[model samples]
Target: MAGAPEASPGESRLRRVPPAEVEAARMEAVRRYDILDTPPDGAFDRVAAMAARLFDVPVASVTIVDADRIWFKAIHGLEGVAQIGRDPGLCGSAILRDDALVIPDTRTDPTARTNPLVTGPLGVRFYAAAPIITADGHRLGTVNILDTKPRLITEADTENLADLAAVVLDAMELRLSGLRLLREEQERRKAEEEARTRAERDTEAITAFATTLQRTLLPPALPPVPGLELACHYQTDSPRDVGGDFYDVFSLGGQRWAFFLGDVCGKGAEAAAVTSLTRYTLRAAAQHHDDPTEVLDALNSALLLDPSMGSRYCTCVFGTLRPAPGGGFSVTVAMGGHPPAFHIQHGDDGAMVVNGVRPRGGMLVGALENAQFASRTFHLAPGHGLLLYTDGLTEARLPDGTMLGEEGVAAFLTTRTTPDAGRLIEDTIALITDLPTGPGDDVALLALSVPLAPATEQTAALSTARTLATPVAGAARADQER
Candidate 1:
């Protein structure tokens, strides 16, 4: 089987092994590090250059053994990219042996004599390769050195190359570790930002839901009393959660009814509580007085009793309505420095307006220990109307720092006097909306019109109509009631 150990001494040095087993070992070594087709790393390049200088070789490389190729992570003195098939790379074959293989003269050896790197491109006549083995005894690849001119390599040179080969393997491990740490840091930052965004969106959604619930707390519909047709508009200017503008209607004794519209000075649940308390107190107090002045005085006392009323107060208008023999009504209105009422009358010309004779007398509710009340009596005949409103509608702000104004309210009514109370409100609201900007406070409107009757209705309808309507169409004084 040994075949006479080759007749010449040069042939004896061939050291043949089974070709099939040798190729299998080369493939096994390449797969151990699991690095293939990866980019060049700085750590490996450092060791490769060091190896060239330390060993005093013409070339050095960190060579990786592939199934059919030897890929270079780094190279010195090689032409361009250092990747070639397994059979051409002398380092790939040298890996099969345990010790370093020094082919002092490749031209004298039959195995490497015809190698293209030695006979062609690299023109190599001398080659020495030391396997880069990990601590676990896995042969990852090789640290190889080559020369174009044949020369003798002493034992000192070979051992130095072997020690440097170990250093290259250690550097490759450190580079792999750093890449993993950077990936983990990126993932942590992404998760924190996503959590913050979710919390902000949830807060906004809950606030809007609370506002819709607050609007439901108001009276959904107003009752139409005979001899008088009443319409009211109560709306919060901002939906940032509804503020405290509220109104109520409940029956009192002797065919009379009690009604009031009021606004607390703040927003949120605290102000809403004040609005609720004022509404019920006015209804309860109406039992004692068909008079508007007495009802407001009782409410003022009730608010003073609440412990939180120290710095808080409300502005309100309380009214009482009684039916007359004819199709008309009389209203006694008392105000606590709230806005004045608007009244409209119909004539041959068209529907006309009258400003309130006087807004009633009182101070901010609950601010004083004993607040005085004054009353004004007015009559509403059939085919006439009265409008009582909160300041929100008149005080809506424009971007120019000018209020939407009492003048704007008058202009709105003169242009559109529709029969439907709800439609009149929507139209007036559109005027506020058309403005480029508006106020921080809420808006409310209450319009009461006398219903027209069948022809047998009244002979005095024309003359009585003039006394019924309040002329809000006139310019209101700046300090009148708003």
Candidate 2:
């Protein structure tokens, strides 16, 4: 306590200390802010610097009054000191008042004359402070400005100091709020990342299970049919969900093979289950009956008996192929609300064309107990073949909003010469692949053709001409049929 003035015989105190309860509550409020003893902050330091410049004071500080000390949170102009005893500083008396305290000449005032800072070697003669009050009516500390020479402060000076103290309180509240918001935002981001990771893992597991089930529903490889060359392809719309399209070729006994292609109503696990039931049922039913129509009738009955089907149905094309008497094949086809098959014929001139053959008036099977199905018979001679496909082909949309309907398919077929089943299928797949948009449904294609003669026997004919000539009689027959 330097520069303290000697006490006179009769002198009154400048300010009264708060009651014990009030002082205890005031101290609790200061501790609740959690700001004391912390490191220097730029925000509070800036306020102290601005206060010094505005008042033209040699020293300015933001100080908090504790039980036994006045501690500086921010200081300007003073060096080598951070705190002092409660009894020696002007800020201690300022904390007991609700308004600013101004001592123009501390040495002349009886209450401040005995203060050590004024009478000691430090020589602080003028001091002004505004109380930093809490929201609950407790004064915690002050924003103080001090000078060595005595000087008077105007009313405007007192108001400016009050405003500066308000700025200090605002900075403290904002800092606390900002820290709380930052912690909440970090927690939200962590939760979202964990949810995303879990979803990805679930999708991978479902896709693997669907792929394994799909493989079991189809034939491993087409059983080689004597006197016929076969090629089939299937395409799925998405790898994440199983599609409803299915096709199989299996043997019934000697010289007879059963083949079927179908599409169920929806997608995913339910449609996959239906597809499996249809495929196995057809294989077993064909053995009990020789007629294609009777086999489809049995399928209709089985679907109607099952309650789990739940108003769902499917469209199918079922057929049996057998060797003809002479040198070709005869196919009996039954239809159940399915697309027609294309019979591709080669002209004598080697130009290839397509002819669609459909069974008349077939009903949607599995939807009704007494649904009707129809059958048709066709002969595949040498240099002839047949192609069966799902509606996903003809229903595909081009960029120009035009559909590749039945006529479009016929035009596609007429572009090729010599009906080779594998080549025809490859060209059809390329057409769909080249479109700007993908087909929204599943596509399945099955082509069966009669093989050409051995290369040795046709070597002389091949040498004579690379292109086959169109005969007058065969051309006339094709025109009459058209």
Candidate 3:
């Protein structure tokens, strides 16, 4: 093999060893590969083995040149040795050259004759190495072949050695890229899992707060009233949100008690705030004013005074129940743009009659500066009941686009055979729940009834009073303009 051309003394002055700064940069680039001192890889082993067979050399190695040492990444025909000193080897000098370094008969070559690797026990006579250059022009290592005996080599052999060096560099780059991608994928999955865990914890906290707040907005239990049986039920369309509909049966002291059911315009925290204010205001006003109409007027004024209640309004039925002389109760109900109250009466002949008691001219409360409400007085005898509810029941839509309107609800009540307050509420709930397309809005029901006793002489008079005091359906409209 013919050795690489040597530089003359004058040319050698221009070809000094790389400066300290340049060598530091080259070493840094080598470290970036992270392949130094690593275990043997099959890909590199194959390349070294191929170079030895192709060139018919006794030894072939894929060597990385560090600052002071030459490390063998892959070696063939070399046993139990992984590295050698850079001062005694050809690979270090090969990395400094831009082209392949070839030397035949090291005993005669001036550069090779001084190398310990050539003059020592394992006498190396012929040597060929290709520099492994990085993309940025840093030569970090070499793929070299050596023979103990001098031999002749063709130009094609030198070219083939350079090609094998390229293969080794490509394998290193491919491995580093795959490792980077895998690390990135693992980091992405870890971030996603953390986000999901945070969301679950947040949802749980919100649900607990909503439930506790909803309980405060409604009555814990209906207040017990003398001679009157009361039952109520409330349901929401979604568990995630707090419903705006509210109902309460609270005592105003003595035999007299106040009850009201209403629905705010929207749902959620804002509506919930309004609901809390409404329930507190109604109870406070009812305690001072015994009249239901006056109580509603107080609410309208409070809502109007608070400008924060922007564009928010509610439909309500506020009522006061008091025991009437002779064995029954008299209820004065005031309506504020709410649905009609259902009255179920049992006749002397045992036939049940259902009537809707609605006071017209009632406008939405809290909507205008001067909204009017309607009030009506009715007598409830034994076996007679009154039902008040929010519009969620009547406005429930069926699959056919038809609503369970006032008529539909009245029909449902008529089919029941004289149910008490509790049974009446349960049956209505069953009807609302059984709809094929479930109720889209929240439902609230309040039922008040008098217990039935055996037929007595006072029964006839009580029955007559209830019939004569029955509130005419649009009676309030006459006073609406006032």
Candidate 2 lDDT over 333-359, as tens digits, reads 999988888899987676886888779
Candidate 3 — what's its lDDT? 0.74
- What is the Cα-based TM-score of model 2? 0.53
Give the candidate number with the greatest lDDT.
3
RMSD of 2: 36.1
Which is the winner by lDDT between candidate 2 and candidate 3?
3
Worst 10 residues of 2 by lDDT: 473-482
Root-mean-square deviation of every model:
36.4, 36.1, 35.1
Q: Kindly report which residue pairs in candidate 2 clash with one another.
A: 2-120, 3-119, 3-120, 4-116, 4-120, 349-470
Candidate 3 Cα outliers beyond 4 Å, as residue runs: 1-198, 454-482
Q: Give the distance in Å from residue 190's predicted Cα in candidate 2 to where it truly belongs.
A: 14
C-alpha root-mean-square deviation, candidate 3: 35.1
- Model 3 earns a TM-score of 0.53
